[model samples]
Target chain A: MTANARPILETERYRLRILTPADATPRYLGWLNDPQVTRYLESRHRPNGLDDIRAYITSHDGHAGFLLGIFTKTGEHVGNYSMRIDLPNAVGTLGVMIGDRDHWGRDVVLETRAAMLHYAFETLRLHKVCGACLSTNLPAIYNYRRQGWAHEGIRREQAIGDGGSRVDVVMFGMLARDWRQRREMEQEK
Target chain B: MSAAKEVLAQAFDVSITEVPDDAGMETFTPWDSLGHLKVIAAIEEKIGRDLNTEEVLAVIDLASIEKLIAGVHRV
Candidate 1:
C-alpha cells in the first residue's frame, strides 16, 4: 500500500501521517545528515539528493507498518516514528527521530512512542516491540524505560559511530502480553 | 479498593496511605523506570485488562489510573 493508504492516527497534540516525496527537501535532508541526529543511527551516509529520500520512502510498506511523520496541532512537522516488522520473528523495531531540536524534552517522543506502541500491539498484532539506543544516550534510554520497556542488557562495544569510534548499545523490549496487561490496568482505573 | 492500594504500594514501594494528588512520579523512589513497569503489571493482574504500551503511558497518574480502570468496563 502507498504510505498515505495507512490510516492516520491522532493524539491530543500530534497528528501522525505518512511521509511522501514532497517531504524530501534540503531542509528535511539536513536533519538526517546532522551528526548529532545520526550519531546513534546505523547509517552514516547523508542523503545525497531527493532521489535517495524518495527511494527510501516509496520502498516502505504503509499497510504492514512503516514510517510516520509527526505534526503539531498547527501543522508543523516535528519528527517521525517508524516500525519495521519482522513477521517470522514476531517482533518489530521502533525508531524515532525528532527533527526539531526545540521539541526535544517536551514529552512529544513519549506520546508519539506510546501511540506507536499501541498501534504495534493492537493493530499489528506483534508479539513484541524492541528498541536499541546508544548507552551514552541516556535520554533515549530513559525515555524508553519510562514508557515500559524492560532493560535487556547491552551489546559491549557493538556500535561504530562517526570517526570509527565504538559505543555500547543498550537493548530494550516490551512483550505484547505486557503491553495488553498495562492497557487493561489503565482501563480499570 | 484495598487490593488497588496494596498493588500500588507494592508496585511503588510506597505507603500511599491515601491516593494523594501530589502522588506522582516525583513523590516516590520506586515510582521509577522499573517501577512503572511493575505497576503496569500489577494493575493488569488486579483489573484483568491488557494494556497497550500507549495506554500504560497515558495512565500517568493515580487519577488517570482510576479512569482507565473504569473505561475498560464500558468497552
Candidate 2:
C-alpha cells in the first residue's frame, strides 16, 4: 500500500484510520506526557516533544508497519493502534494505546483490536498476529486473554517499568484460523 | 440505587448511598479506568451475561448503565 493509502476500520462507537503528521498535535503529545497513560509503555522512558512525534509519524509513511489513529465516532482522537507487518513470514505484531481515560473499561480496546485483527487476517492475509505487554498492565493482558490470544511466553526482567522497577513482558499470539473460529463461536452464541 | 448502581458502588469501593444518580468518570472521584473495568466486570457478573461491544461502550454513567442493563434484561 502507498503511504497515503490507508483503510478505515470502524466499530460500533469508534473509527480507526491512518495517522498523519497533522495528528501530531499538543493533545496527542499530552498523552505521551501523562505518566499514568504511558506507565507501561516504552515511550515513558524517554521525554517526547512535538518534533519527535512528527518524526515518528513521518517515519511510518509507506512502511511495512502501519499506525492508525483511534477516534470516536463523533471525531474525537482518543488513541492509536500500530501493526508491524512481516510479509515474508505472514505475521504481524500489534500494539495499542487508549489515551482517553474516559473511554476506558468500555471495551474500546477490544473493539479496536477486533477491527485491526480483521484487517490483518482477512485483508492482509496474515497467518498470525502477536502482541506483548508489560506484565503489570493487567487490563491489556486481560483484554488479550479475553480475545482468545494465547499466552506465548514471558520475558523476565525485559524492561523497566514505572519507578525504575524491572518488569516481565508477556507475549501473546493468535492465528487467523483460531480468530475466525472464535468469531464463529461468538456468532453462534 | 438501582442494581447497576449498587454494582458500580461496590466496584468503586464506595457505599451505595454515595453513588450519585449521574455518577460517571467525569463526576465520580473513584471512577478511574481501572475502577471502570471493575464496574463492568461486576455488572456482567450481576446480570449473568457478557456485555457485547456496543453495550459495553454505551455504558458511560449510572443512567446509561441502568438503561443498558434494562435493555439486556428485557431481551
Candidate 3:
C-alpha cells in the first residue's frame, strides 16, 4: 500500500502507522545502537545505521509485508512492529520492538499485536501468524502466550545472546480459527 | 520512600517499603532492562514531562530518578 493509503491501526493508547525513511532520525538510530535495547533481538547481530533503516523503509514500503511505527496517541515515535508475509503459505512472521525505554511494561506490544492480528486474519484473510523470540526473553514469551499463540517448539541453540551465550529460540503460532475462538472466549468473560 | 520511589516500586511489583532508597537494576532483581523502562515511563507520567536521553540514562536508581524529577520541577 502507498504511504498515504496505508491503514492506521489504533488501540486505546497507541497508533500504528507505516514507517517511512523520515523516521530514520538519530533517536531511531540510538535505539539500534543501544545494546540494552537490542539485546535478544536479531538486529543486535547486524551493524545498524541510518542507511540500514533507510534501506529497510525503501524495500518494504509498499510490499505485502508491513513495517509499522508504533506511536503514542500524542505522536511519540516509540518503536516498530513488522509482519512479513508468505503468500503461498498464507502465513506471516511477526516482530516488534518498543525502542522507547519509557514505554516498556505498558502492554504496548500486546495492543499492537492484537491490532496486527486483526488485520492479518480479518483484513488480509491470512490463515496463520507466527513469531519467534529468544527463549530467555521472558516478557515476550509471556505476552505471546497471553495473546493465545501456542508454543510450537524450540529451535535449539539457534542463536547467540549477550556475551556469546547460545540460546534456544522459542516459536509460537496462532491460526485464524484459534484467534477467533480466543476472542469469543475473552468477550464472554 | 518518595512518590517517584513508590512509582518505581509499583512498576517493579514490589512493596514500597521493600524498595530501598537506592533501588536499581543492579541492586534489585526485578529491575531488569524491561523493568527499568517501566519505571522510567511511570516516573515520566508522575513528573508530567518526557525525559531526555541523558536524563533517562542517568536515572539508574531510585535516588537518581528522584534527583532527575526534582531537576525537572526546578526548571
TM-score of chain B of each: 0.68, 0.85, 0.81
Any runs in candidate 2 off by more than 4 Å, and if so which?
A1-4, B1-75
**Off by more than 4 A, model 1:** A1-5, A45-48, A63-65, A187-189, B1-75
lDDT of each residue in B1-75, candidate 3, tens digit only: 387678887787778888877676556667654565577678888788876433543555677777777784342
Clashing residue pair totals per candidate (backbone < 3 A): 22, 0, 0
User: What is the Cα-based TM-score of model 2?
Assistant: 0.72
Cα error of candidate 1 at position A135, Å = 0.7
Give each prediction's DockQ, rounded to 2 decimals.
0.05, 0.10, 0.05
lDDT of 1: 0.70
For model 3, the stretches where C-alpha displacement exceeds 4 angstroms are: A1-5, B1-75
Which should have the higher lDDT, number 1 or number 2? Answer: 2
lDDT of 1 by residue, A5-79 (tens): 575788889998888888777766776777776676654544456788778677667765587889898988878
Q: Provide i-RMS per model in Å.
A: 8.4, 9.5, 10.1
On DockQ, the leading prediction is: 2
For residue B34, model 3's alpha carbon misses the true position, in angstroms, by 5.5
Candidate 3 displacement at residue A128 in angstroms: 0.4
